[model samples]
Target: MRDLRARFRAAYGASGWHLLLLVGCFAVAAWVALRLAGEATAGRMLLWFVGAVVAHDLVLFPMYAAADWALRTAVRERRARPASGPSLLNHLRVPALAAALLFLVYLPGILRQGRETYLAATGQDQQPFLARWLLASGALFLASGIRYAFRRWRARRG
Candidate 1:
């Protein structure tokens, strides 16, 4: 069993389950592409897809990479103990990423750009979006800070 597993892993560069999941994802993507190809809006969809790829590669990736590099440099400069169990970088990163994603998802609402159309469609005002987003972001950061403090306390205690 071990030999067979090793052979499969050697051939696939991953375990059987991982390979299966990869193939499943590919199959779903192919299905979605085929369906999209048959649609009248395929060209527009393709344009959006290409634009997203280009925007992420050319804009978002570099921006985030630079931010992360700067953050790491600052953290490294301030570190007093070399024996810390884990860095606080990820703790900050996870919440910031979540908040950023939420902001992106609700950008039009947060900016109050679609007020008339939103009111017409939903019969509700878009006035709360900015406040809600701010509150959510603040809560997320607070939770992340508490979690980091707890982890640091446990690390020091143990």
Candidate 2:
């Protein structure tokens, strides 16, 4: 059994489960493509996909990569001792990523771009989106800060 597993891993470059999961994901993607093929909006979806890929590759990727580099550098420079675990960089990163995802998901509502259409459809105002997003982001940061501080306190006590 060990020899068989080793030979399979050597040939596949990962465990059998990894190959199974990869095949499953590809199957789902193929299903989605087949379903979308009959849709009239497929062309528009394709155009949007291409645009999103271009935007992420050309703009967002660089911006975030540079920002991460700067943050990592700043944290490393100020640290007098090597981090034991859960570096400050990661604590800051988690909140920032969560906030960014929230902002991206609610961009239209937050920016009030389709205020009239949104109001007509949901019978609700878009006025609260920006404030709610800000508050949620602030809460996330605050919680992360509290958790980091607690960890540091426990580490010091130990």
Candidate 3:
């Protein structure tokens, strides 16, 4: 049994279950792509996908990579001792990433860039998006700060 398991791992680069799940995901994606290809808007969807890939690779990737490098440099300077466990970087990163993702997902609404179309489609106003995004971002940061403070307090107590 042990030899069989090792052989499977060596052959697949992972456990059988992981490979099964990956193949299942690919199958679903292929099915969805086939369905979409039969639609009239397939070309438009493909164009948008290519645009998104280009935009992310050419624009967003560099911007975020630079931001991460700057953040790491600044944080490295501030820490007195080497990180022995999970670093403080992740504590800052998680909330920032979450907020950024939320902003991106609602970019049109947040900027009111699609107000007329959004209103026409949903019969709702996009007026609250900016404020709501700001509030959510603020809350994310506030929670991260509180968690950091609590961790620091615990460390000091210990």
TM-scores of the models, in the order given: 0.64, 0.67, 0.65
| Pairwise TM-score winner, candidates 2 and 3 | 2
Model 2 RMSD, rounded to 1 decimal:
6.6
At residue 56, candidate 1 shows an lDDT of: 93
Clashing residue pairs found in predicted model 2: none
Better of 1 and 3 by TM-score: 3
- Model 3, residue 53: distance off in Å is 1.4
Q: lDDT tens digits, residues 76-140, model 2?
A: 74442435644588888889889988998889988999878888999998888899999999999
Model 1 TM:
0.64
Model 1 lDDT-worst window of ten: 77-86
Over 4 Å off, model 2: 1-47, 77-81
> What lDDT does model 3 reach?
0.83
By TM-score, highest first, what's the ranking? 2, 3, 1
